[model samples]
Target: MVHGGFRVWSGSEPDFPRQAEQVRSLLGAPDNPALLPPQFVAAALTGIGGMLITRSRADALVDAAFALPTRDPSVILAVRHAANRPGATRLTLVARDRPGAPDGTLVDLPTDWKAQESVFATDSIAIGEPGSEHAKQARQLQGQIWQSPPDNLYPTWLYAPVCPASMSLVALHGDRVVGFLLGFQSQPDRDGTTVLESQVMGVDPDYRNRGIAVHLKHQQAIMAGMLGIDAIRWTADPLQAGSALLNFGRLGAFSRRFLPDYLPFRNELNRLPASRLRIEWTVAGEDPRTELSQHRLHLRESVVPGTTCPIANDGPMDLQITPGNPLIAIEIPSDWTALQQSDLATARAWRTNLDDLLLRCLGEGPDQYLITNAVIHRGRVFLLAEQATNNLLRLYS
Candidate 1:
């Protein structure tokens, strides 16, 4: 059993097939091969179990739709399990083009089709502000994930209350807390502008790759907008490829500052130096998805196709300095944790290489650069950075 009072249900939970079918029916999926969000498809097919969410639970997710004055009974939120991948489940919005026809086929609903907010209710998980009980669960989850010493642990209850209600988010699967994101308002800058500083986010081991983290960040952005905040700032380990992809690729955040040994203590799970990349996300500007797609296209056209810095099969990769170049692509291991476990020496060397490169390209003055987006091409992962004057970045600004 996992800590945090949450149970890790086995892949074969009670009434699994029936549960899957109910979700399919809710979406008007006459067949299992219907088109849906690709991210939802990839996650479900690769996960450990089929649709774990029940019909009533799925209905609760779209309960918001019922409140809309123009609510269409023909349109609703639903889920489907991948036919080939036994345990894969998908969640999305669908609508019947011909509501009155007996054989009306359901189609993918437009994301902007008169919806207030996209519900992130995959696998029956719900996101919201934590209450007293939920806070206790969140605290337990934090302890389980980080395993910090008593002195190092965050005082979740003592601190969370001080944050705006919407800023402290919790993810619940039924009555059990599966994930949480803690953030607080930062001190006003010289210009009197304040932003939300995300302190930490964690999801259950069994529940990752299910889009939980992405949903948490999206929900956080929504809440920040309501509070009139314009930006959100956070720091993450520079060596973690997943963090880089999510921060820069998916969310369109950019980093200009790299801090060495940002944290005095070391985490047992990942014992490397606690260097971090400070990232800033503009919440009130152009949509992140739109910006990311545009940025990738711009990079492909302007830069070499294989500009990804090479990674050594053994030992640390040799650093190649290209001073004065407008762009730099630095590659990090796709799975940093696995690399550390398998070969600590190689992992350390990779960090040393990154430390050297980041300090130079992302340093101060005219030579400084911004790490904009991370991408995977032909099985290689690369972090893309460029000078501020680049046309694409100028448009992003």
Candidate 2:
């Protein structure tokens, strides 16, 4: 996952300053493109890497709504991300009106929505499938999710249904696009395919919490089930506690496959070792939850902390690697994102240490370990593992 940076020029001169200044104005006045000029939109698209986040849900919705041109008759509410906010929250604009203006169908949007210091959504948000018009916005958000260049974004082919190979969904508050999830049918290898691969998912920085991201995954899984897919496979960053809890605790997907440097570090927000664990969700059956619930029991094991500490910490314990144990546990920092921001050098050291320790414990080659479960208790994050053994049910006893 990567995104490319851009350099902007107007005519013969490199007018980055004017373009940058204009971007600031246009984001707030997306409805009033005349407030600045469409040229700024073009410039931000071609200028340095940027993100346009609004101060609140109301602001974002208003900004997106402003994208609606008064004359367009066929277009409905147009929600799109603006590619022009470097070192700032990328802006998304609402460009038009919905057909027939049916009210009360979508989640009721409040007229006096409050501005928020933090970008996140409450439980009262709307989730639905987006049209091809949203392809650019989705691509931009996907790239930013990886903290990569916009050029690294997914092409329209993957999202717009022209290929009929993937399912794309987004969450919104009014016209403001808050979150998205993309899953595509896994290509037929030599064995043929029966699974869908969840490729990329992201929530607006301000519109997290309230289980918005998890709901997106849930909806995608349901859609896959409708399409007669049997399974869904995806990767998760091992260092993140919140993500671990959601995937393992809430969703019940399990894994033992540990991949190092699967995603390269970039941008401050994404700085960390590129290690990730594989996750699989089997969709078919009368109740997928039954098998998943049983698997959860097998993966849950009592742990002696610090026994397999991947990185040094000043916590309650300093430990050693345990080998041949039917069940294994690895420790990770409590809040990796905060650790990266507050102490970057230390974070990198943690990444280097993880690279060494995880490889030693899980094995460096592919399919070495199957990450079965993860938990956070007593302010520590532990990933449960066992060699690629399938008799996990026996190990539980």
Candidate with best TM-score: 1
**Tens digit of lDDT per residue, candidate 1, span 252-370?**
78888888766555665558887789888877744537755666667754654244333222225655654666677777788887888788898899888778778777844575678
Candidate topping lDDT? 1
| Residue range with the least summed lDDT across 10 consecutive positions in model 1 | 62-71
Each model's C-alpha lDDT?
0.58, 0.52
Model 2: CA > 4 A from native: 1-122, 143-147, 189-193, 285-292, 295-318, 363-369, 393-397
Q: Candidate 2 on 139-199: residue-level lDDT in tens?
A: 6676566575543455443444433435777777776667787765453334533566676
- Model 1 quality (TM-score): 0.64
